[model samples]
Target: MAPTATRSPWPRVGAIVLLLTALLSVIMIAFAWPATRSSVHDIPIAVAGPSAATAQVAQQLSAKRPGTFDVTVVDGTAAAERLILDREVYGAIDVSSGHPQLIIASAASPAVAQALQQVAQALGGTDAGVPVRDLVPLPADDPRGAGLAAGALPLVLGGIAAAGVLTSLVVGVARRLAGALAFAVTGALALVAILQFWLGSVEGSYWLNSGAVALGIAATALTILGLESLLGAAGLGLGAASMMLLGNPLSGLSSAPEMLPSGWGTLGQFLPPGAAGSLLRSTAFFDGHAAAPHVWVLLGWAALGLVLAGLAAARTARRPAAAEPAAEAVPATVAV
Candidate 1:
């Protein structure tokens, strides 16, 4: 018989190279696109002054960067400050006393604050610098909020790692899940301590901050664990990729969500990473204002993951029972 032809190694090698290239390209786009395309688009900012002055200021802002700022006219600076504290606005342009003053909440978003500062400078023309007041300043040790932004990736990676370890090392579904939860709690505590006490990135009640971090880690780890339990190795890969690629880049942790082009920012807030970052920020600085929505999102993800895990566990439990009858029949046949 004629020998069968072997497949060419070059084709397999080429395919691998192509696949790797495609993956790298996607990763680059995910991480770089948002940052490069970032710009102010309908970002909420209050204007506090008389009707005529506020209208003119609003018109100028629109003319300068059309559709950039969603200008809300308020009665006075007091009203504007309330909105900022409530997380309704990023910053405000106050012309209440016939002089423009810039009120910023740097803790909410340092990027937005810087943008507003530039706008404030422009408003002052060449005469003098605009009077600036930071309503919510970041911690003295970490004034840029670099630590807080940098902390987001580690949390995501830690949760992914937790899921991997539990799935691989733990024997039963219940045990794996318990381990994941325990890791979430302990990991959150450790991370929060480092960020809060050591790095000075986070502020507010320690317990509250720890709780936020724990919930975020739990939501991520449980979701990944559920996927792994249900679909095995493939499920784990899917979960990890989704969290890293789709969730992390769109998280808006490094910058305000509104800064992202299109509606991706809003969509990010619905995902685990984004929700976690926003929730943590709120708890740390805003006293939990505007935190309910993010809390619900995380809870929803965790609940769904639990349901998936239960289904997988049920399936695993049934396999042994189904196999028992076949084994018993095998002994009878062997005796015959």
Candidate 2:
């Protein structure tokens, strides 16, 4: 050990900066690219008319954009409307009339509705325009979908913030959980007051919307907290990455799941953000018709998070006092 090699701290610091820069770049690219390149992928639309007309319309649409529209043939307009309300299809075309009529659920997605309008117009030709009707229109107050689209980000940020605060301020699993729950309830109420009452963005039963928001916040916060408890710093990083990188863009809030790049949309629905968005939409517009699954998803995440936190606490409590000495010895050896 006559000539010990001394490593400069600058190199380590520079490498960390470079690595972080690269990571940020990757994240930015990953999120931006998919959103910019978004196109209709297997969007479900029904054709309600005679068998011949239905087949003709379906074939024509398929010809225009191969694999873009999943055209289902229904007996008549009533059947199509039923499907739309049931959340089976986004829009439906009634070729039963001389001029085609497009029925859309704007509550589902205005962008998709516009796209369907374009398709219907194209089919009907320039002279005979396709008459478009919105079955489930968006709220008069929030017609542009700005509110619904913007909802997910706040919830995501709120969850992360809640987790960060609770982890730093509170100790013990039970206390952390209680903090998360408290934050969720209060946060939901506050958000509802701002976005729903003041801004008039969110429209629905106040209690239902608030409850949905609370569940979403609780699920997100508890999940992050659980991960932190179980895996320490690494767990927090993982949770953040999952929510930001994978969950955010794939959420399908601005568009329907079918509008996203195939499997990615479906994948997003399994996450808390997507589930939350869907649940909120259902509650707001569909009168909670298709909200059970989304509710279950949120509940499942909350349950799992609680379980994980409990296990982590129990494990920490059970560790022997002698193990602390051994753990300290290992770190000392590593430093040497």
Candidate 3:
């Protein structure tokens, strides 16, 4: 009887299945828990008024929800508005008048604005007379932020799709790079056209929006491609997990990061999707004031991806050529 094969594929298959199951479990927990358990924690807000009254109000608000706010006392309403515009604070409360005034930049986050309104109302003792003002309101066309929030998932999906297509169909480093660039430009144009021009959700310089979207796509594509080049198929799995499982839900595109559960907001901001979302928001609404750091983050990821691709290409180039079969005719001479 022929010797039995020593190695079995079953164990490897089982291990892969087990690993994937564990990964899925982790992904569900990370995403679901934060979303379900979300609450205010250390959200920055300004309380603007006479120093004594502002301090008292701040103290009261903090007491009501300890660790919910990082309250700063601003001298006046103008100062608070400036902070909001600078993306320094989400909302401001002015207790100078007989009725408390809650000032919010709804463009920054409608959820945050709503929360501030609730807090202000609570502070007013159920008389229900607090005036909530939206200093930087969202576009009237997309008043509920539905359009912008809806854009995030598509952007992520588009990046993943583009990368997957390129890796499957394209060959050679130069060709892949070129394909990525072309896709980035065209995809950005189409997405911006739909979201900004047709839907009117995003309001900004057309060129600026186009550039931001393009950079985001390029960063994502390059990173995925780089991982594939360096680590083969496993790299693709890791990339998908990072971009989809970890990045998307934590992104806080539908709401401000500060509005999410503690620590998750900051963690999300460090990832590409979060950075892209923040950058897009700045370009569309805030006149690109706070977009520099996010831009840098995207660029950094792109650079890292390019570097990995280059290294992989170099390694592939240096691989030894396979040996050809030996000439068959020479074997009979010795027996003769």
Best by lDDT: 1
Which residues of candidate 3, in runs, are more than 4 Å off? 1-24, 321-336
Candidate 2 structure quality by residue, lDDT tens digits, 1-336: 599888779989899999999999979975886687789879988999999889888888888889889888998889999999888899999977755899999998888999998888889877678888999998788897888798889988888888888888887778989999999999999887777887777777888988888998998889988999999988877887888788778889988777777788898888888888888888777777788898999999898889889889888887876588888777444554
lDDT of 1 by residue, 1-336 (tens): 999998779989899999999999999998999999998888899999999999999999999988889989999989999999889999999999998999999999999999999998998786687999999999998999999999989989988999999888888878988998899899999999999999999999888888888888889999999999899999899999989998898998899999998799999999899999999999999999989999999998888778889999899889999999988887555555
All models, RMSD in angstroms: 3.2, 5.8, 4.7
Order the candidate numbers by TM-score, best to worst. Answer: 1, 2, 3
lDDT of each: 0.92, 0.86, 0.84
Could you tell me how far off, in angstroms, the CA of residue 127 lies in candidate 1 after the best superposition? 3.3
Q: Give TM-scores for every candidate, taking all chains together and pairing residue i with residue i.
A: 0.93, 0.90, 0.88
Clashing pairs in 2: none
The residue-by-residue lDDT of candidate 3 on 1-336, one tens digit each, is: 999888868989899999999988998887787688788778899999898899789889878989889988988878998998998889898876645788998888888888888888889877765788888898888988899898888877777787788889988866887798788889989998998888888898878988888888888888888898899888876786788887788889888787677788888888788888889888888898799999998899888789989999888876633222334434656665
Give candidate 3's TM-score.
0.88
Predicted structure 2, TM vs. truth: 0.90
User: Ten residues in a row with the worst lDDT in model 1?
Assistant: 327-336
What is the C-alpha local distance difference test score of candidate 2?
Answer: 0.86
Q: Using lDDT as the measure, what is the rank order of every candidate, best first?
A: 1, 2, 3
